[model samples]
Target: MRLIAAGLLLFGTLAPTLAIPPPTKPPCCPRHEVFTECGSSCPATCNSILERNANRVCPDICVRGCVCREGFVRNRDGKCIPPDRCGRDGHRPGDSSEEESGIRCHRPNEVFSECGSACPETCDSIVKGGSERKICTKNCVIGCTCREGYVRNADGECVLPEECPRHESSEESTKCAPNEVFSECGTACPDTCANLDDPKPRPCTRNCVIGCICQEGFVRNDEGQCVLPSQCPNSDAIASSSLLLAPLPECGPNELYNECGSACPETCDTFNGLVENRACILLCVPGCFCKDGFVRSKDGQCIPPSECPKPTGSTPTIEIITPECAINEVYSQCGSACPATCETISGRSPPRVCPAVCISGCVCRAGYVRNAAGKCVPPYECESNPECGPQEVYRECGSACPPTCRNVLNPNLEIACIDKCVAGCFCRDGLVRHHNGKCVSPKQCRIPIGIFTVGSSEELNAE
Candidate 1:
């Protein structure tokens, strides 16, 4: 009886241990995989179609542990995929296949390849017939290449080498002088010594022109020769050289000879406000100009400015009126180019660096900025606007890269933040923006699935 009681007590203690099943081992099979006691010896894979077509055989056997689900095969990445996607080619959809047997090249006499030459012979290269050898890169590229005895044409089609179009040589029937080169497309406004010292900007036709152009660092001279800029004759030398031809004609009173005179000469009729804003061609005109304090008469004679004719109409006294301005605005002869607006009233924006030129307009008064309604308002009024949400403050200049729930937990993440400020509502201090565009405390921030917590709240808050 004593042995039976001891045995019963021992069995009772062991029964509880046996009743609790062993902690189930975590599943080792990844996604798209299942544990199997008996798996196919030769399961379908990315290369199954090619292998089957080659009459490859599969031995009757079992593969235990894990296998892909039905109708799915393992790709090169060991991920199960559909049978139709087996032996798929490029990294993107609709791309040409790299498989030798399944490739469907678009152009004739072309074949697809997994590894081909980076630089292939083209029709243009063959037509040019240069003795220089092409330096091809060794990097492998997956694309279509022309078959033997064929080359890629300009139209991106593979054609026989003899079918390339012939181009006329630009140098044929054309001769280039020293320091000049023949170009199929040259600039219409070739640099010349006459215009080299001119400060005005000139417009030229944007067209492909065939002609001879001066070589680099050289310009054309008046004698039609390409020479270095230092070799060009100066103004005094040119004037002395021209003296050999003929003496300049004598000028009238208050007149002088000008190699390049103003096209819009000041005349008696236009001395006043008659032609104040007239547009004239900015070109050099060789003629005589009036001396200082003199104007040209209609008879082409220079006279004193005081001798110019006056208008016969009666003069009326005109009153200068100041423009009426809205509230909080004042009329000024000069206004800020970078005007203060609701978007720039926070004083957090960069300092305004406006040009010294005056801009006549109605400008906001001191400590005021224009609002969305085009009315000048105080900075405090902007802060009181209802555009800001709860726990968010409106800023004229706010951080472009604001803290969000996606990056709040991982503040050390590298983000391309612009240095400039943006106008928007931003989260207040000790708060972060949520994915739903609401502001909340860091502790209340919900971490994304892939991101895990690293430390306690105090450590994160301190950071």
Candidate 2:
């Protein structure tokens, strides 16, 4: 429903003749006041997707201007937003600390990712020093060498991995950078919260949440509050938390909690349970859990068993997350070892053996050339390294394994074929070398690296 104001003012500040029209069949009623002026009629002048997009976002229309709708958000152009987020926080959405702050955020967040994505909106400084923050990415596969103030952890979280235990020997003072957050942890700031007025700094201090502290001299009063102007030497200290000093951006126009000053929910599950991570959950209330053998989660509420059962079928598909992939690790069950391989990251579970097993609906891992049996097999040999090298002997001829392989990919495995099997070329052509067996065009067979012998000089006759 395009808006038609109730108890509102403004005889006609807006001129619909120039205003953007609402969508076709916009939901009747329940539409807010901001969109009221947007007119219920469709605008024949614009594209239909624009009409639909505008209506889809009409929920974010602020009665005032083009702000976001209550509980919803808008972008710079005043478009509707995603749950508890802006476009991109520029931080790994998976990082733990980034999430906790999301909890303390304003909206349910589970429904608003397009608004509150990044933080601080500004930083004291973003310095680039020695590579102490090892960024584990495709660009730096071997092992990232991070810069100062950042350390690479096992799971590859570039954090303050190790802190030189406070030297009891010397009670010297540690200086904080100009505006850099410095605590016992490290110098890197918090979610760089888009909300900056939060005078007391809270970074990934304790565990992962934002740990707030009173300014230098002031201590927390009993009310769990810190009276700034009266308590601190400087008046500008507590001026933050105030709307005037730190106005929550009018960015999200109609959003209910846009500037409400509270964190949002992290993740949700319709069934098993909203994770303990951000206290972000909402299921079947106190009455809902899963109905027995069936399971329900935020994503799937009450999934019946046998809908797609069988874990060993040629194209097996399970009801939910499979058993293998239950353990915390990465790249466990693709046919051959490679950087990327899974159809889905089943969170934590036992590895799914390929060729004979799959999570039912999940796609086959990469590097595996599906066999006639439909089981996933390595692109090369399907046997252990011992068959190709030494300790690789005990290696099983199956997919999925514990994360303990010292070196991945057997170097002695069958080589990449340019055209067809080389032996086939030799046997059919009287043992003469035929780059490839497939009697095809010469351009198809690429030259092999490091394999051309000195005496084998024979070029196809040309003009």
Best by TM-score: 1
TM-score of each: 0.25, 0.17
Clashes of each: 0, 71
Report the C-alpha lDDT of model 2 over 208-254, residue by residue, as the tens digit.
22234444423333333434333333335544335234433332211
Q: Give the candidate number with the greatest lDDT.
A: 1
Please report how far candidate 1 places residue 418 from its true position, in Å. 23
lDDT, candidate 2, equals 0.27
Residue 311, model 1, lDDT: 60
Q: Where does candidate 1 stray beyond 4 Å?
A: 1-103, 131-135, 170-180, 183-463
